[model samples]
Target: MGPLNGFTVIELGGIGPAPMGGMILADMGAEVIRIERANGTDPKQMRDVSARGKKSVVLNLKQPEGVETLLRMIENADVLIDPYRPGVCEKLGLGPEVCLQRNPRLVFARMTGWGQEGPLAHAAGHDINYISLTGALFATGRRGEKPVPPLNLVGDMGGGGMLLVNGVLAALLETASSGKGQAIDVAMVDGAAQLMWMFHGFQAIGGWDASQRGANLLDGAAHFYDTYECADGQFISVGSIEPQFYALLKQLAELPEEEFGNQNDPALWPELTDKLAAVFKRKTQAQWCEIMEGTDVCFAPVLSFMDAPSHPANVARNTYIEVDGVTQPAPAPRFSRTPSTVSHGPHSLGQDTEATLAAMGFAESEIKQLLESGTLGR
Candidate 1:
């Protein structure tokens, strides 16, 4: 059993951040029951890594009986993950007010891109749009180049999903002492902005340049903190920011002291970067790894998704696991006493509907009626 063994979460099924948050809770030993729509489309269910370690139940929320059933479930659920926009849940009669009224200890977490009550709260936006608003997107990419979307990792997963998980866990802990729960309005924009706090601080202290995208120390402007192309066309990243680490990198790469000395001078960065690029291109990623992998040079080969799982460090720590023939990342942030584990892979839609309803104390007759009435699905 893990840290959240005794907790129960009711995840209102949708895609993106909410499912990701639910997966994390399930991994941590919570009984996360996903209430999916009766006619939902999950064409890639088996490969949807975010759906792992959770149970799924189909319910036709358009029906009053289904809404009543969800309310009943919420009564016993420690947390309810609402992925819809602010008004969607209220329209379905499953809003925070109604759910909290039924279960005063329920932590109703609302996950959205714009938050519960803002001018853009009801706007249709995706990860890219949300991150763009927070300056996170603009802060990425190379100099004089268009900002590249770093996939959906920054907003959807990092800002939205991880933020929701953090809030839920903190609320759960507070509930233990207060014996009450509260609603958390988790917005991707807000969370993404929060992630930029360090950069904002750096800019305030004149250590960072906010006007230029790639002119900051950590934003690929410095010679010692960027990725270089190797001879094999592969890439390696180096973050030798500290003085000692920069010295080690210089020594390992055989960079001449006269040319590479003033590590912090911005004017010398472009020239030094060109020199480093030439040096790195002299060897393959593997060859460079041999010399600098375990050293204080703060270096690593930029591996592709196909190659990452096989890395020695990842292999040693079991950072990835295969579930239902799908290779994906393993549960993280290991605990000494209550380590998390993935109990199973993604469940098919409504796979656990009858069983879940029965466990919720629904009579067989009532369940059969709901199924026949189209309020429940197989």
Candidate 2:
């Protein structure tokens, strides 16, 4: 019922990005099977949103029988997501060379912070370290303050997971034509850097000032593009960058032309910002919403996580959904036909192991042997 309805993806499960990529594919109707370690930690708890719409199979890759079983599954799988550090899959005898040899049309997608080979590829690092290497971390936060971590959204989900999904889809398309598959090396550092292309272009053309963080147009320095606190201490964001929208903001806020006329003057920005802040503070958020929410002023109240699902715009669009008593975002990039859906909520560890192995043509006797040997978890 989705765009990737017939495709099958094998997710070598880990934390952070790889699971997110797998969930995206599953949401798009790909039959995603997560390969979890028999004795490894279950990264997803009861409310873990990223585990949605996927099936789990526990396999002890340290066992030769388990590796052989995975190879058998790879023979018919379309995609494999590897989320480990470099050479970990090779140590398990499940590297790209082995897997691609087993299935010529398989897409082997590998994700990492530092990529396959580099000085720091073997070193351990998190999203903060990866984004710090790029300019993403440094460009964030207020001026004169240390860079704040953007909650792993930039490096892990945006750069690592989404980049892997993109590469997988592209490779799948190419394989459809050439009848050959390829390996994808997705690095968070590389993807995060690529994400900064706009700023890089701005810097190249002198449209951006890289000298200071908050002095730039979009970096909270501009009064028209920053968040303001309302009378009730709630926050609202304003992005009235266009002159017409800026004029509307000025009119709605009742700012005199003499004080707010020169909108783009950098020297006047501080004084004007103070005046605008004071004006916004005079009214509560609801009052400001009544005055300026849906106008050409480009305004929206800053909604927290708990408050976001119930927002009028989001509720109208069904942007958030509830599954198994947990509220999370719905499948995105709506399609005119074959729209995506969440088939089911998260499954327990090894919930589908026996059924999956049986579907993979493992005889009942062999399944019993594997289970007895601890190659397959209960």
Query: Residues 189-279, candidate 1, lDDT per residue (tens digit)?
Result: 9989999999989989999887788887999989999999999999999999999999999899999999998999998898888889999
Q: Tens digit of lDDT per residue, candidate 2, span 1-378?
A: 989999999999788999899989999999999999767655345566777888889999999999999999998799999999999999999999999999999999999999999899999999999999988998988888887788999999999989988999999999999999889999999989988989989999988887678778888888899999999999999999999999999899999999999999877878888999999999999999999988999999999988999999999999999998888999987998999999988888888899988998999999999999999985
> Distance (Å) between predicted and true CA of 159, model 2?
0.8
Give the worst 10-residue stretch by lDDT in candidate 1.
38-47
Clashes of each: 0, 0
Candidate 2 segments whose C-alpha is farther than 4 A from its true place: 42-45
lDDT (Cα atoms) of all candidates against the true structure: 0.92, 0.91
For each candidate, give its TM-score against the true structure: 0.98, 0.98
